[model samples]
Target chain A: MGKNKKITDYDMEQLIGQVLRYGVLTSGIIAIIGGVWYLIQSGAGFPNYTSFSGEPARYTSLTGIIKGLTEGSAKEIIQLGVVILIATPILRIVFSLFSFILEKDRLYIVITLIVLLIILFSMFGGLKV
Target chain B: MNILLFTLILLLGAYLAGLAGSLTGLGGGVVIIPLLTLGFHVDIRYAIGAALVASIATSSGSASAYVKEGITNVRLGMFLEIATTAGAVIGAILAIYTPVNLVAILFGVMLIFSAAMTLRKKHEDALQEGSKLSYVLKLNGSYPTKEGEISYKLKNIGGGFSIMTIAGVLSGLLGIGSGALKVLAMDTAMRVPFRVSTTTSNFMVGVTAAASAVVYLQRGYIDPGIAFPVIIGVLAGAFTGSKLLMRINVKSLKVIFSIAITLIALNMIYNGINHKF
Candidate 1:
């Protein structure tokens, strides 16, 4: 309650430091989770494109790398696209949260809440792509 | 196509993209998109989806450091994110239905513009006063510098927000990191200090990407295989860039690389014009 404790008087650098610490931690956890999920789902094999598989089933072939990722069924590609889009952002959000915590900034808590709300709304909105 | 090999290639691309992109401050999209389309022959749409995911990863990795260093304005970034996110949702929905050709054309045009923007020089020793909106939104801060401490005031919060809306739409639609536009909005339009502007732009980018990412996810654009390796690479690249921030001559690199992006954008437009599938 002291006059010296005004909100405007708080150090920006201190807040930022807290944000960085918590942000990295938050992102690291999400990345670990998402990376693990992707690894598990794709198996040890590379994520192959359905259209590029052809009759030869070439894995080690140099030409196969370009062929497989480029030419895939739209449906399959779309599925992959969505997964990539969602998981990375969540990882980043978790990281940002960690940064905020590291900075000891309460502001990011609210920002995180808003982000959560946006995610929920986006999830439920029934609009794809 | 061997799954293992494709993953390995993407992992290498991601690593290089992260390292080089960060060193140049352009994010990994410049390298990632071409690698996917030209190198991997990825469909533009899928390539964009992958690029967007990687963009989020790069920003997330680096933005945290920038933010902690007092270079990013969390309040300013959060305030503008509202606009960007709203625009992103709308853009993502549009991206799903927009003819692939149109998106390709737009993407190309955006890349050209981004290149032009990147070539501009930074204005130092010119910290302007805060705008009326900045006063209302409380957008102001300081940063450490060789010259000692430099405090800056936000100039055009509303204008920056407006630009962010457009930037968000583009991010969702094209899968390119809208960092250039975000920086322009914060730096030129809003007249925020350079470091603050760049860091804040970085802070907000993930959220912008997230907005579209969710929509893309619902629309089924994310592939686990592609997303995984790309993320791994971009995160690595971003880390490398941050470590080498002091040593790198980012401006010169951006100049050289912007031309590369312009070429890709032109080719993309050509492909879009004659798209088969």
Candidate 2:
């Protein structure tokens, strides 16, 4: 706490405000592009919209999303955008964790860390049950 | 139906969902899920997944504004997210495992519960003695006001945490943002101000939606065809709806939309009972 450099607490708030605003707007644009591509490709006729065909592996999981991003896959890119949208809030939480730590706020640091862990566990744990 | 027509129809429906949802302060996530599942005859799994993702959009659109205005208590949101995210993960897992009929019925029941809660106009958040947890965590904070800055404190930490968990579980299980339930917990049990609670709840909904979204994604519940349009449409809808809220009588619109929500809930419940998607 004593060793930390001091800055306005408002800095963290402002940074987060920008993060949430831009994350969404950027993701929204990407999603629209991906969607337009999808409709054009599938526009020939209607497929069975009622059937539940699980998306291919390349577009469903986090690693798959990253992999698809490196390659140029439209649906996968859409998924990647969705992934980004989800990641934004998680990033917000991470930002808050560091802010708490920098301020040397013990209780909030612990609480924020616990929150971070739960989110990471949920994202990475892949619990089947 | 042709792809163009299908896309156009779903887009319009989602747009309306967003407009009405945002206008009601309920978030479009709720309406879009039921709309996709019941109105459009899509699978419930896909509906939930799309709704969950669209909720992130809603959060981003609304929360950034709240944050910039300083109405959102980001610290408070982060602290409570532990319960919410954990609950969301558990609920998402539950949704993955539960039968579709059961999920639909539960969603319908939740809708009824939410509408009943909102049917009354209860805005009295009385002053209360602060809790020990609030002191330990420094959960008190201030917001801007006309006269000056008005500071507020958190109470019933234990109760707030419990309610948050329920809100999270519902969000994940149903694939909606669950802002109504979250606001109720913060404004009532926690004694946060109305404005602060709404903004903070909006801020937290994204994280909760994301926590469940990954699980849904891994399970292949989300479809690009469905999710893409839902997200874009809801985004456009909320974006415009925020602008629209200023020009009209928001309360009267809420009254009309609230009835629509009730009917949609009943329709979902009926479909669930009959095992008809």
Candidate 3:
């Protein structure tokens, strides 16, 4: 009954609760650091939210972002921080999946995996009209 | 000089929007978008992207609080997410091709529903029995209220999932939290306890927004310069508002704010039709 005992005591609520709280807290700190850094660099002028343009080719992809990070650009760091914030929920889902697996819940494992697949497909499908 | 001034204004406005949004139980996008477009003459697309950042920030921030209290039904939220994520991806992708007028009009319709839902007296407070789908998925839970720990049932799983998908698409297309639509689904269509629905919806909104945001991110629609202050301001505002919820007669305030948001949604429609851009 060790496995059964472990399943009941695993305390998914506690585990998931921590994941959410820490995920948000960590992301918040990262965003603030990036935001303040950008604020100082921009001087006193207002940001132009008037236009929509694709990011410059030099900063277009993940590689571009990594390179910019190495250069210590404030903008890249900020972008990276936002990316982390966006990833937080997805992280929670993955954590939940693992928890289900540990509990040996066959039904939940499949359900969680299906949801995970849809999210991944949405994120990566690039099927825009 | 101008950039700094704009930054300050956006920061302050987003802070206020976040505050008002949380206070009224209406997420921040409606407030941020109107302020951006009508107040600052920003493009709708940029406004949408910035709103997305702000909405996700407040949502994740508050969700952390609610999830800890064990109010959020993690399993239920995940199951319904199947529809929401699929709808969101489609809605966002469709948004890329849809004309601005259509988006604006659809936004107006969405707002009308949001206002109506907000003003309507709370019902569906009774504990529901689990549907067949709920039995299969084991979707039910309880939360501690002033009364006691109330165990509730989940009904209408199919309808709830469908509504969530639509809500997801709107979130993607408009870059708003579209939380109102989600709440409506859970409360009315799904027959879950209102408290449970609200908390679970918050937990789900972040993921729905992220799904749509992926598209925006890839397209370079998100601007770090614009999003940074907006995120910072809204997060601060929402934090303050949440703290203040204890001291205020928040229900009345929410009604007034909901009406104001409805008006702004109308304005968005008008502008979209007239091609104000």
Best by the TM-score measure: 2
Docking category of candidate 3: medium
Using TM-score as the measure, name the better of candidate 1 and candidate 2: 2
lDDT of 1 by residue, B1-277 (tens): 5666786888898988877666655667767777877677766666776787777777777875675565666667777777777778778777767886787788778778878877877545545676676665556766678887687786767778899989888887877678889888877887777667777777777778777776665444555557667766777778778888977667777777888788878887787788732
lDDT of 2 by residue, B5-92 (tens): 8778778877877777666778777787787777668888788888888788877776776677777877788878888898998898
Reference contact recovery of candidate 2: 0.74
Each candidate's DockQ? 0.20, 0.68, 0.56
Write one digit per residue (lDDT tens) for candidate 3, span B12-95.
998988888677666777777778788887877777777777778777766766666677777788888887888888888888
Q: Each candidate's fnat, in order?
A: 0.30, 0.74, 0.61
Candidate 1, residue B19: CA error in Å?
2.1
Tally clashing residue pairs in candidate 3: 8
lDDT of 1 by residue, A7-59 (tens): 33245445544554454445444444545544445545544442322213222
TM-scores of the models, in the order given: 0.78, 0.93, 0.92
Count of clashes, each model: 35, 0, 8
Interface RMSD of each: 8.2, 1.5, 2.4
Ranking by TM-score: 2, 3, 1
Return the top candidate by DockQ. 2
Ranking by lDDT: 2, 3, 1
